[model samples]
Target: MTQASESHNGLPTEIPSCALLQLLANSLVLSQTAPYLSCYDVLNLAATARPFRFLVYHTPNVFRRLELGNVKTAQFDIDAIDRGGETWRNVQLDENLTEDDFYSGPLRGIFSNLRRMDILRDVQVLSLDGLSVTAELVHDILVDPAYSVRILSIRGVKNLNERKLRGALQYACRSSRPRGTPRLKGLYVFGPRDTVPALAAAHEGSGSSSPTSPATVATAWNNRSQKALSDALAEEPEAWYVRRGSQFPHRISSEWASTLVACSGIVSFDSVLCTGPRHFNSPAWGTVNTEALDAAASSTAPSVPHFSVATHSLGGCASCGAAPEGWTVWGEEVVASRRESDGRRTSESCMTDLARFPLLAPPPMHSASLRVAMCPAGQTVRSRLPFIPTVKQQKARFIPRCFDCIRDRYCGGCHRWWCESCYIGPRASSPGGYAASSTGPDSVSSPFPNTSAASDDNAGLVSKIRDGVCADGKCSLGQR
Candidate 1:
């Protein structure tokens, strides 16, 4: 078995040709030949040689992303990381570290909305829960000409007293310098139950759209908002201590007119809490009155209060998902009252799907002549229920959501929640006025890059591409 002993016993003294290369080749063969290798095998393979160990250690593209657990942290340095990408969740800690080992952690605060943009963009979703992010820091990030970011989703910072919060939204996303647009213009803010009202009055009118206000988009969008809407639209899950207002991106004046309007057959729907469709099943559906819901179902009525609101909050048949308990139906009136007895009839009707309008406001549910269905979306009912995703996110590091990303293989792109026939397919068939991609052919790349020319052009293209830039140089093409 020993080479020296075999040579001594009468064999060629010369060693086998290229033993070092052959051993290296054998190791490579074993790596490829093994149908499957366990994590231990991988570690063993890394131990094979110094070069192999470093190859395994520094390889970034091995995973589409690196995920860290709540109790775990990656000792990763992202400098010049052209090979790998990583994402962190529950990255926030309730306790501030004692020693100076602080990058201050990830962002955990609610942010105000910013206008969409067109440019090479960098987005960072920051959370600011129970902590303070000073205005000076924001000024440095936003005001500094070099620190331009496309999207900034600030979540959870409900702890900032009123003054700091105001400064963040007003100036952080905008710049005072002339001829200079704000790098942080597209902003999203959430948390602290009072922020909405404060910002709403400042941006839009106190209750309705003003010709001068940009936030005066529509009241219908906010009329049937769930309490989670503010938190959900933000960068994080339902942030506790969040300030709730029904209408977001709404003109200030429209706030007065928005309310949760209930349709027939359903009694109560919780707008603040998305307690999954409890049927808003009203006793009126079976015994006293069924016409209100029937009208909404039929889509008929010229006399009902035109400026009304509705929702799936309790009227449509389960056979047709058109009316969920929180969906807003219109053209009918539901008399809403607070005294528990004042009864005025409110008609309910749904519009054709082509336009996709939202509920404005049902009548007001109040003590005197409280319209039976005028409760606002922000108004809470007596029944308390835990939100579905909130309970789920608590246990998981991050929910794998394919809703927004289109490149996902199985869930690539949200075809279900959004209109499929509309912008769902190819951008070519998309309606002229609508599209998320502002850049035309000049900036876009062909999805089918398997062509011969593409292969030649991509000389150093990665094998299992975790993420990449396309011909147009877009950093987010096919990003998971």
Candidate 2:
């Protein structure tokens, strides 16, 4: 009777914080398999009664990523303290959002919070194809010393201009970043190869140094902080690496390796054409930048990409173009682009062949110089070289025709080939079907088919493949 009276009175507080926490724990366990009880659904339970609400309010740490939708309204903008995250955050506004709603309202509020914490941040990965982020706002982020944004993806952002984009990038590393610890490491600016440079130029938060002495502009791009990336996992499986081309392993060749080697950490290396593959939204370059030659090669590939007269080598109309350390400007650039339109015949071209890329490719005109973007999170200053070395004229003169290009004319070992080289593997046989060395794993199969040097001891087996005979089943020399 006394217990019933106490229950009816419902004194000051009915339950303790421990009881609330216990409820949360129970809900989490129930949510494991029940499709109806989502993690968010568990949070909603807090609104059910006072005990449940106490648990949700006290333990906020359980939420790492906070997202809301049409029905919900919320956000998170705190200092990056200890946790590797960006402080100047940006999220979509609470109302009706269109394509142009990127830089204002909700995003601005988020960035303001980031500024409070002084950490440069980035969206995990996003394309800039139709975004309306203006160059001015991006410039503001670049110029700030505390700026720490890396890898800005403006895939299809067309509103950006070249000069402004350049300014934004130069602003990133223009001076030292906040150093006691790293908030933001490197920046990556990606998009459909050609369309992105302009945006990168304008929205380039991967700042540059001061424009004082002429020589200051002469800096080489190389990636830093490799130890951190290496220790990330003993050896990053091929899955961890991504090239500009295909899905899985990010297919890339030697031509794109220099840029890859320059980026410090384990990065998803994007492939862009130095002198070709200009179309960004075409069906051909749908998911990646895969060229024909890369698709054919199998087994272990060349450590680096080989160039060709028709492919890699590029000579610029360099009043606006970039080659290595020593290259001269040949002419000015003119960039005119024609997007996919209403039944209009499309036109595009390569970076070198005047016929393909006449007038700085596509030809309307953007800021052009004889330098490539310096750091993945950086940009290059404009400078002229005392001399210009052409790619086609390089010593190797490597060409890529096919995976099985073992023809004598294209074989580097054939002595007659200069333009291109045939494919060979360390595995078993070379083009002439000879082992690179008899001691390696790929050495000719034992019993020595046609191996005259040892014929005196093993005459019968040695004659099997030596005289273009396949006496024994599965002999490569005989197949050759």
Best by TM-score: 2
lDDT of 1: 0.27
For all candidates in order, the CA lDDT equals 0.27, 0.30
What's the true lDDT of residue 370 in model 2?
15
TM-scores for all predictions: 0.21, 0.27
Which model scores highest in lDDT? 2
- TM-score of decoy 1: 0.21
On the 0 to 100 scale, the lDDT of residue 21 in model 2 is 43
Q: How well is each residue in 1-480 modelled by candidate 2, as lDDT tens digits? A: 222122233321334335644444453533322222333564567578665554444333232112211112222233222333333335323344432333433444445653563322322111222444456645654454444433233433444554555444544434364443222232333323232111112213457654455444332111223333445445322210111112122222333323323322322222222322212311122222223223222334442223211222222211122211122122223334576768665555323212211111111111111122221111113212232446633211111122222221121211121111111122223333333345653334322232244322221212222122232334332110
